[model samples]
Target chain A: MATNITYHPSPVTPTVRSSLRRQQGLTIWLTGLSASGKSTIAVALEQALLRKPYNLSAYRLDGDNIRFGLNKDLGFSPKDREENIRRIAEVAKLFADSCTIAITSFISPYRADRDLARQLHHAERPGGEPGVPFVEIWIDVPVEVAEKRDPKGLYKKAREGKIPEFTGISAPYEEPLKPEIHIRSDQTSVEDSVKIIVGYLEEKGYLSAPPEVNEV
Target chain B: MATNITYHPSPVTPTVRSSLRRQQGLTIWLTGLSASGKSTIAVALEQALLRKPYNLSAYRLDGDNIRFGLNKDLGFSPKDREENIRRIAEVAKLFADSCTIAITSFISPYRADRDLARQLHHAERPGGEPGVPFVEIWIDVPVEVAEKRDPKGLYKKAREGKIPEFTGISAPYEEPLKPEIHIRSDQTSVEDSVKIIVGYLEEKGYLSAPPEVNEV
Candidate 1:
């Protein structure tokens, strides 16, 4: 009995909040290898979503951007990485709860970690009735391709044994078995990748609303 | 250098996100004792804010609600409490970055932790330019009054030695040195408290647009 802590939020449900904000909340979780163009595609997708006439606001949570703030205390250790992923998942849930489309770009290398993130979104609420819609997109690219496109030169460093525990180098980068959307960043243009993902969102009925209108 | 890592996001800044979202981001942190009506006042404030004409969408982050999801891994220990507050603060920053007015209710009994949160907000972005506005609201309620008005019977449990490390009971509560808005929750009605907070927000130039309009 003592262990049962109930959460009583205001009568405002996600549906109500969604109506008020004129947008449906969804989490676009992008996972892939380092330098595989996750952040780039995410940015393109965010810009594309912003250009839409619908009443939607997509918020981006770049892995690099978050490392400087939310995951600031965390390191590159396995345990720290798990905690970092967990915290990001929680933050994404909170953002979705506010009826804002959450776009998260991270190199969540471990399958277990990414699965945990999905599970968190699946049953985020107190009683776990209405789960948040999570779209896990895999930016698939070969290590060689990623290394060639390494703007940060991280691939060369990881190969030179400079950065330990680097994904696709020292640490293992577990690939997603069946992602919602799979695309090779090397082959596909950022615009095409964003288009594909936005098409998925639209097909899933997330864009089922009028343009820039409010309901009382 | 091999040790260097670069993060490339869109040129859009928080100001752009705020403008595009058509709302200014604000963080109203409500701190007080257990059963001191922080969550109640926060809910009322949320309702009041919802009635505003601006494009603002205020999201409530209740302690009880978050513990079931984001802070579920944490406990009531000192270290865990510190980490809990830190994580919540980070999430609030993310919410604010999305141009949502974030209302958080927590009994964050440590001044250092709260100060760290404030600093995190003031220096949130990578460039450290124009941080989000954070308003610390102290729901000042006497310990006797709080214990008398124990809605969840937490005070009784703490007094009976059933719940250790309770703020204002066994654990110490370090009050804010100078909070932006301070109100006695024990003496004030929830509606009145919400009105005072809304007035503070208006006075602080957070209410920059028209009153309530729900979009469909």
Candidate 2:
């Protein structure tokens, strides 16, 4: 039921919130395989963003925090993985709308799903600058290398019946054909890797300058 | 092709940025139909939240903004509508995550969708309160009263083919089986509607005291 109850109650505009966040910065999404230094590179990138004169908010939608909370409902099935990416993409768009460096590190193995995420970045914003930088950073590390440093022993468990539909082990991992940046985890030193990513951001005009404090 | 690369990058925690925002406060979300007095009461509610001692951030996610942006790609189809609610739920969750009072208004036509949204509130946040209030307020006005007002002339257009599948007109509007609060828009004045909503908020502990402000 409806009435001619035309009342104008609240006054915080979507444009105001979006502009405030945009005046800060853009989001940097990092996608890769497990144990491929996605988190490490993303952290380095955030520190680099922070050291600059301009204010930059960085958010990471990763396994430990996001999976344990927002994405806790999802299992390891392909359909679940697709839904998982879809939800994260939407969240990343919100962070981007708020004008922050939203760095998301997920083992988003499917190219189509990642591209679908990229398409969403342009759709739902206050219509100014881009909201999130939907960057596809492929941390190209061999399965063997990842196996050697399997901190979570996820691969081993996948080999056993402990985990189902695990990527790069029981399941197939489709590599990114045209990632924005390719970081090989075994060959590059952490310092050089961070530098390469920071350099890319600077080149893309995301960073005002190189970070004042560089991590070793 | 994958290769071995070792990158020693520092970990950047989101705690600082999250803390800075949390130092601000929490948000309250109000959802219902068009001409349901949602905006009318929401404005008064903002005044109430602002008057309190807590750091307040409030925003109303209404029809115009959503249609123009986030849910633009989605149609009025059942699947699209579900996705529409899902996307909004995710955004509302984020707003709650940032500790802002996010009052969203829509002619949400389904109980399943409403229940799904209620489920999001139970989702736990790190070092913060759960993002959703299990409370749902139904603004119960008869269809005849709603058609009479036709504030936006929407009901008329819906009757025509101009706006296809309009809720409560061509399509369906499922009534809430058990809402936390119910306000009859026809019987109550705008001011009384505000009082009733604010009263419920106070009863639910969303407000500190009786709201000193009222909308006429």
Instruction: Give all candidates' CA lDDT scores.
Output: 0.80, 0.62
Top candidate, metric DockQ: 1
TM-score of 2: 0.63
lDDT of 1 at B90: 85
- Candidate 1 docking quality: incorrect, acceptable, medium or high: acceptable
Expressed as tens digits, the lDDT of each residue in A103-181 for candidate 2 is: 7888888888888888887554433434346667888899899988987677788778676667788777889888888
User: DockQ of candidates 1 onward, in order?
Assistant: 0.39, 0.09
Model 1 backbone overlap count: 11
Ten residues in sequence with the least summed lDDT for candidate 1 chain A = A207-216
Q: What's the residue-level lDDT of B191 in candidate 2?
A: 80
The list of candidate 1 runs beyond 4 A from truth reads: A1-5, A124-128, A210-216, B1-4, B209-216
Scored by lDDT, model 2 comes in at 0.62
Full-model lDDT, candidate 1: 0.80
CAPRI verdict on model 2? incorrect
For residues A181-213, could you state the per-residue lDDT of candidate 1 as single tens digits?
A: 999888899989988998999999986652442
